[model samples]
Target: MKGFKFAGIHAGIKKNDQKDLGLIYCEKPSVAAALFTRNKVIAAPVILGKEKIKIGVCRAVLANSGNANCFTGNQGIEDARACSKMVADCLDIEEDHVLVSSTGVIGANLPMDKFKTGVPDVVQQLSEDNVDQFADAILTTDTCRKIVNRSATIDNKKFSIMGIAKGSGMIRPDMATMLAYICTDIHISADDLNKCLSAANEKSFNRITVDGDTSTNDTLMAMASGTSEAQINDAGSKKIFQDMLDDVCFELAKMVVKDGEGATKLAQIIIKGAQTKKDAFKAAEAIAHSNLVKTAIYGEDPNWGRITAAVGRSGAHVVPEKIDLYFDDQALVLKGDWQGTEAEKKTSQIMKNSEITITLDLNLGQETDSFLFCDFSENYVKINADYRS
Candidate 1:
């Protein structure tokens, strides 16, 4: 955090005059690791960033909203390169060391003229105090900025980790549904940092769903400035850094789910007592992505049948007779049978809360998994239907 500067500005990329461009610059080249969307139709920046991240070092990151710069053929790649080069030229750094990201409506070309005129001014406004602005500038439909900070000490040496993310819809977490940038002041190897990021992502971004759609420009990246001089070479120090990183990413991921487009309830689907962790995850993911389950939650209905149907079709190992289901602490189904209208009434009340948990016990083994998701509503449909208009 100490060696980084942030900036956000309205570069005319967005028609509403909102801040659409953001920058994060480190005083020196920092060790970097990144994860990108698994979707084959990726944005130009995602393609370029993946190649540049292979070197494990970066000096700055430039991100823009309001244009995904995808499906534009070779011109999209040229525009992405031009944007990165402009940032490199303004900051006197190598173009390869400057990474780029973009989000918003897909299949659009980037406005190079905006970058040609605004890059210098945006660079001039960079400061350590502008992190909030940078967070806001990366958003598309996100109602609020998601930022988190955590610290840890190892061997009497202190380190700081900070992250910012933006997501509201088109979130299914194939690799992070939206853009997130993390900065740390600890010294660590790029390989170690990558391992830490992947582990953290599995429990955080990879476990959340909103609309079940993976965007073309999903990315999550981390950089270590090594300004703290706290070396994380040994196993003990690495564990400490990884734990702190996981907490930050988890909190940001929760924020993304909480701010899901037109979502009023945040629900956690837990699948337990499975034959394998993979089976549990499969079942939980199915329940999380089911529109029927989501709408039932939105309407405060204890629709246990929809949940069971989703789990049964999930392809996970399951014994219908051994299943048990609960809404929060109230039982809706016991031993694979509906608990009657009285139990359904209680579960309905529980679903009325802003946050609720739906637990399913397979009664097969000890393996368990869970996913964070949100309720579906008519507003979600409206928001996406007219998003570009």
Candidate 2:
């Protein structure tokens, strides 16, 4: 935050009046690390970002919403590059020092004219206080911006880390989720920053789902400005930085789910006591992505059978008779046996809460994994039905 300036402007690319262009400018060239979508058909910006991030140093980020630069063949890359040039020229930095990103409707060419006019104006408005605007500009169907910050102190030297994210739907990530950008003022090498980010992401962005659709333009990146003079050359300092990074990333990830399109409830799916971590994750992923399970939560229905069926079909090694399920502390199924109508009624009450946890005890080995997700609603359908109109 000390070395970063941000801006967001209405570029007129979106149908409404919301800001469509965003910028993140670092006063000094900063160490950078990035992860992209696992979707084979990635957007042009992702292709370019993969190349740019290899240098491990960046001066700026140019991102736009409402027009995902995907599937436009060679032209898409050119457009993404051209947009980067606009920011670089305006900021008086080398073109290669700028990273680019986009989100919104897929397979459409960027309206270069909108960017042509919008880029310069947005760049002129950059300031350290403009991060909220930058957050807004990167959103698609998200109801609100997601931002989290944490601080680490070592020997009285303090450093701050800030994370900003934009996502609502198409939120499952194989490696990265939606569009997340992290900035910190800690003095750390690019390799060290990459290691910390990779670890933090596995526990955060990689564990959330909305509609189970991975975006073509998913990106998670971090930049370290070294402005705070808090070096991480040793394990002790690194651990402090890692803890702060993890908390910021996890909080932003939860905000993304809570603001998910048409979502009314935020829930954590925990698969505990599994034979292997893989099996735990497999069952949790299945339950998180199941429409029946999500809709049942939305309707406050005590439909434990949907949850049972999902775990059974998840390909996870499980002893059917050894499974126990609960909504919060109210057990709906105990050792594969229903707790009956009275318990169902109480479980229904748990489901009505804005936030709750679903725990599945496999009664197997000690390995376990978890996921964060939100309930599905008819508004989710309505929101996506005319997303392009």
Candidate 3:
């Protein structure tokens, strides 16, 4: 809340001459936690952030776009280290007290000269009013800025959490879909902060998909400044802060789905009455990632066969005769039997909306899970194919 400074600057690393650098500074050592992509081929910044966060307290974060610094092996690691060290030197903090993140073309080397010129300017421009710039500077294909904030009270104390994220492609569950940075003034231990962040990611960032591709540079960072002086060690305060944080992250996650590159519709796929939570996820993800299903949604075609086929192959122990399906509020299938043409017409209308909800009830057990996804479009293919050009 107080004494927080953030800055964003154009570092000339991107080919388009966009602002590709950002930094966040907290006056005091803040409790810090981070989650990186589960992809085995990780980026350079992820490797460095993982080690820096082990110190349990962080005073600054440095991020860059346009080059992922991945696939270069040992050189990538050295670049990450050197960048963080540069930021530390400018801020007069320990090298381990600063974290770094990068997103862009994978397997390319970073231009260290960009860091030499940008880190010092970032340090000089740090201010409380530039949080939005930091949020916008980290984007790749994002169409608009994504940010969400919330405030809550536990006992007589109040706290606030604000988060910014960017992801329009290369999104899948394994961890965060893309980059997310969350900051709060709540007082919580680094251990507790990590715990809450993991729990929240499971139900939020980990449950979304776009193109079913996981990135090598996904990173989620949360910093708790303890500025509110409200100790979250107690159960009540912990619950309040965790709920607030989860809500903020969930909002950002949904925003990612809605902004999926060239996406025409945002979809909520719910699989219910499965034998287990894992089964539900299997069914949901299978449908969400299917090119046929996504293309159908894009065309506004209520094709039930594609949906059923996805469920059958999901390995969810689905019994075709016992399943029920709905597109939005339109019931297309009853007890696995297709309704008449009238119902099909109504469901087609439902699929045409900007936001659509599809439900599949297995009629097996009470277990249920949902995944958020976006419809595939021609623009998505064009954007990725010509990304570098």
Best by lDDT: 1
| Candidate 3 or 2, higher lDDT | 2
**What is the per-residue lDDT of model 2 for residues 1-389, given as tens digits with 9 covering 90 to 100?**
79999999998999899999999999999999999999999999999999999999999999999999999899999999999999999999999999999999998999999999999999999999999999999998988988988887887898999999999999984876679999999899899999999999999899999999999999999999999968897899889999999999999999999998999999999999999889998999999999999999999998988998999999999898999999999998888899899999999889889999999999999989999999999999999999998
Question: Candidate 3 on 209-321: residue-level lDDT in tens?
Answer: 98999999999999988888667878877888888888999999999999999999999999999999889999999999999999999999888999999999998889999
Per residue, candidate 1 scores C-alpha lDDT tens digits across 178-264 of 899999999999999999999999999999999999999999999999999688978989999989999999999999999999999
The true-versus-predicted C-alpha distance at residue 9 of model 1, in Å, is 0.6
Local error of candidate 1 at 148, Å? 0.4
lDDT of 2 at 61: 94
lDDT of 2: 0.93
Instruction: List per-prediction Cα lDDT, in the order shown.
Output: 0.94, 0.93, 0.90
Scored against the true structure, residue 241 in model 1 reaches a CA lDDT of: 93
Q: Give residue 36's lDDT in candidate 3 (0 to 100).
A: 93
lDDT of 1 at 20: 93
TM-score of 3: 0.98
Candidate 1 minimal-lDDT segment of 10 residues:
229-238
Residue 175 error, candidate 2, Å:
2.3
Clashing pairs in 3: none
